[model samples]
Target: MDPSRTLVLNTIIKEKAVFTLFQPIYDLAKRQILGFEALSRGMSGSLLESPDKLFAIASKQERLSELEIICREAAIKQFVSLNLPGKLFLNVSPKALLDPSHPKGETRHLTEVYGLDPKRVVIEVTEQDKVDDANLLLTTITHYRELGFQIAIDDLGAGYSGLRKWSELCPDYVKVDRYFIDHCDQSVVKREFLKSIIELAKATSTQVIAEGIERMEELKLIEQLGIVNAQGFLLAKPTRKPPTELALLKSLHSEVRSSVNQFEQSMAIGWLAKEANAIHECTQCIDAHRLFEQDRKLTSLAVVNDAREPVGLLHRDQLTEVFAAPYGHALFDKKSVIKLMDKQPLVVDEQQELDTVSKQITDHEFDIRRHIIITRDGRYLGLAPLRDILKHITEEKIRHAQHANPLTMLPGNVAINEAIEQRLRSHHDFSLAYIDLNHFKQFNDLYGYASGDSVIKLLAEVTVDVCAQSSSFVGHIGGDDFMVVFDNNDAEVLCHEIITQFELKSKAFFTPEHVSAGGYWATNREGQKQFVPLLTLSIGLVRPDLQHCINSHQVAALATDAKKEAKRYRNSYLFVCNRRKPTVSTVRLENAG
Candidate 1:
């Protein structure tokens, strides 16, 4: 290090010439600003103007312990001044903690100066170098934790000896570096590494945060991987004064939550019936008989424990036959119903997926328990008979098949409507692209019906392939029209790719003579012969602003309008409606391959 630079660093530390800025960290699941990380900054145009340079110069001069203490004091005072609602993430060095005058009990005392609790402070230890004394560091961390402070290990994968630090210290939170998060969606190795880290963190009872999420795609992928907390510039930038109200935090959280829910629902089973229609285990046989006689539909009753957990099931027919026998009522008129209950009954969890649960029930041929008890978390929720489960499963299969397009076998209007409602109900921003092939009728007329079916099938194949990699839902809306519900913000880019693929494959649909001619001659609707151009696509895009549109119908109406406008032009086009307003942007896709 230079002598002059060392002098400047010492002068700054001695005078406490530094201030702190805060960057917000968001909670993806709760959809709120969880806390702000304190960042240190020096006076502009000085040797230590930026955090990187400041820390670098201090570490070189062997005065980093002094510099960190000064910076922390200023940060704490300012944070108290602002009266921030969430936890404060304060950076600390293991060497600084071991300083003779570091004041082990001062953290609790300092926070109490402005009516602050030490519990709200999270001491984030950054592992720049290996700790010389791991036992001392662990003891110091435990001391702070006992005073109601939290511990976090920053830049886990980017630093040296981070795994050892994590294993020994066992911080409450582990922050994954941006190296793993940057373009995570595109890299299989990064995704797998992050998933394993998350699993390890879960096993250790530690929460993981994906740091440095600057792109929408990165944020979407990280959230999909189930990391519930994150800090990044895409969500919010660091500011001198952190925001008290989390307006942007709420918005991005809704987007992440909606996308995750929609993706999970694509493979979800239909809602199952819970524990309803249950009878107490202590009811007498005569009283149970009277209740059954009152309602003919009550063919069976589930006997539950004091905690409302299912114990057994009682078949009405068997019990009634016993009472109907001569001198049978006198023999067991006052006996408890528990004596007659079926001790071993079919008990299934309510959350079991439709297919798996159905298979379990039908696996045994001789067992004829009339009703299957549905439970939630080991507690009786309701009763579902074999009849109800079979009916529901059958209806779901029939619904799927009936709503599928005959030619492409993709979801049709019925399934499309349900998917739209599901997305809208999640209350997140998403795009619904209404895709239609232009002059499809002309192609069908020029070629044969079989040729037309091939084109439809081709469109379906491309749409499915594009959507298969994403959390998007694709449906064939009959004829040459289709629908796509996008989970990511790359709707336009995906559309362009789809159009390019379709155009490349368009030549194969035409004969060489017709291909050279560009198109075929066809009679117009006015009964006049005119030359029509080759097949093109018209896509109407509508992304409902959840703040304005309350239902899927409103979004569909806007998209339909955009579709009409897109179809006006002869070339392939993408039209997007801004919102409830009529303003739209039309992208022409002429000469696109």
Candidate 2:
């Protein structure tokens, strides 16, 4: 150990010169700041300016606990003074925590002094040093928990015996190290590790927070992996005065708002709920049997509590069989209906999407005979028969099929129009892209209709693959024309990706000579020989003005005008019409040979 560095550390601790910077952690699903992780730094430009050096010096001097306490105090003081929203995560080294000289109840005392809630402060046990006495460390953690502070295991995968510590501690939150999170989107091994962590978290009823997400791809991948909490520089960086609101959070909300199932919004489970008789849980089995016998149409009866909340579901066939068995009536007749009813019946909220409920039923392998108990605010509302749900889903599917394009099997003009109108009615901000193929007719004339069809399919495939990432809806408007309704402002990114992927993939359709020449001889609409360029996409993107656009027709007109503007360019082009302003921006992407 450097004696000079140790002297600097002692002076820093004695002077309480530690500074704290907070980096925000977000709930990706909610698009809101969940909390901030406090990072401590030493005095700037000093020999021990870096936290690593400062702490290393303190550890060698056996003053780590003292430094940690001062750091925590600084972090808590600033966190409360700034009036930051959500929990404050303070890093507490396990070695410091287990130190015999470590102060007890110091964090709770600080919270009390600052008038902050203990529950809102999280003690992040950093795994920087090995703990020789796990029992003692656990005891210290238990003391913090007893004080109402939450516990988190920091840098989980980077630590020794991380899994053992996780199993022993059963921390409320586990922060995966940045090493595993970095470039996770491209690494299958890292992805599998994340998946296993997620599965274990679910099993243990713990929340996983992915750390060090510096790229948008990492954020998207983590969200897709079912991680809700994330912290990274991409979202926001650590600052003494952390921002309460994040501008980047708007994109997360947009993705969520746009991804709402249009079909679910149009047709909710409430529409299928049929009024059915519900019996009290205390009702006798014989009485339920009699009611079923009297009402032949009643396939199942909902068992409710005194509060009218559904407790269980009694299937009529199950009840009838119980009574039909020899001496079965005598044994079960006097018992409460709750005894025979399914204790864990499938219950759904009335406002839930039929498709979502259908998935729940199918995924759980629920018996079709049991009625799906529908509730409004936890009270019994009505019952929906599985057959009714299936029939409605089937009818909707048929309607969708009828309006789908024959070639691409994508939603046709009618469905596209309906989607636009639905978004307008809901007063949602969205962008619509009108896509058309350039020189499609000439290409068809030269290569025959089969190759042209393949090209169209290629565009459809590319559009779907790109837009699907943002939960955007793609529709085949007709012949080489298509449309996409984007819920977020990343339409430009999606458009670029679609064009890039199509350019790369579409090359397979052309002969090497034609690809090299970049043109083919074909007869034009004028019935004269002309040089036709290779296939290129023309996209016109327009953000609809929800206030001015009264219907899909108006939106269509705006998009159509934009499409004409895009077609003016010779290469694959995108014309973005900002309805909020009069300005229009055009991007010309060169066609890939």
Q: lDDT scores for all predictions?
A: 0.76, 0.83
Lowest lDDT 10-residue stretch of candidate 2: 584-593
Best candidate, TM-score: 2
Instruction: Give model 2 RMSD, 1 decimal.
Output: 9.7
In terms of lDDT, model 1 sits at 0.76
Residue lDDT tens for model 1, 1-593: 67777777877888888888898887654455678899988865787778888888887766777888788788888998988877899998777787776766766776877567787899999877568888888899999898999999998888788888888888888889889999899999998888888767755667788889998888877766667578888877788898865676555534433433444442222255643577888888898888888989887888988877777788888898889899889977788788888754656544445565566556433144487776654567777767767777788778788878889989877677777777667776678888889988889988889999999999999888876555587888778888898877888888877888887798799988878998889998898999988888888887877776665556666777778788988888988767563234322221111
Backbone N/Cα/C clashes per model? 5, 0
Stretches of candidate 1 off by over 4 Å are 245-248, 253-398, 406-409, 413-438, 441-477, 481-532, 537-593
Error of 2 at 108 (Å): 2.5
Q: Name the TM-score of candidate 1.
A: 0.60
lDDT of 2 at 331: 98
Q: Against the correct fold, how does model 2 do in TM-score?
A: 0.67
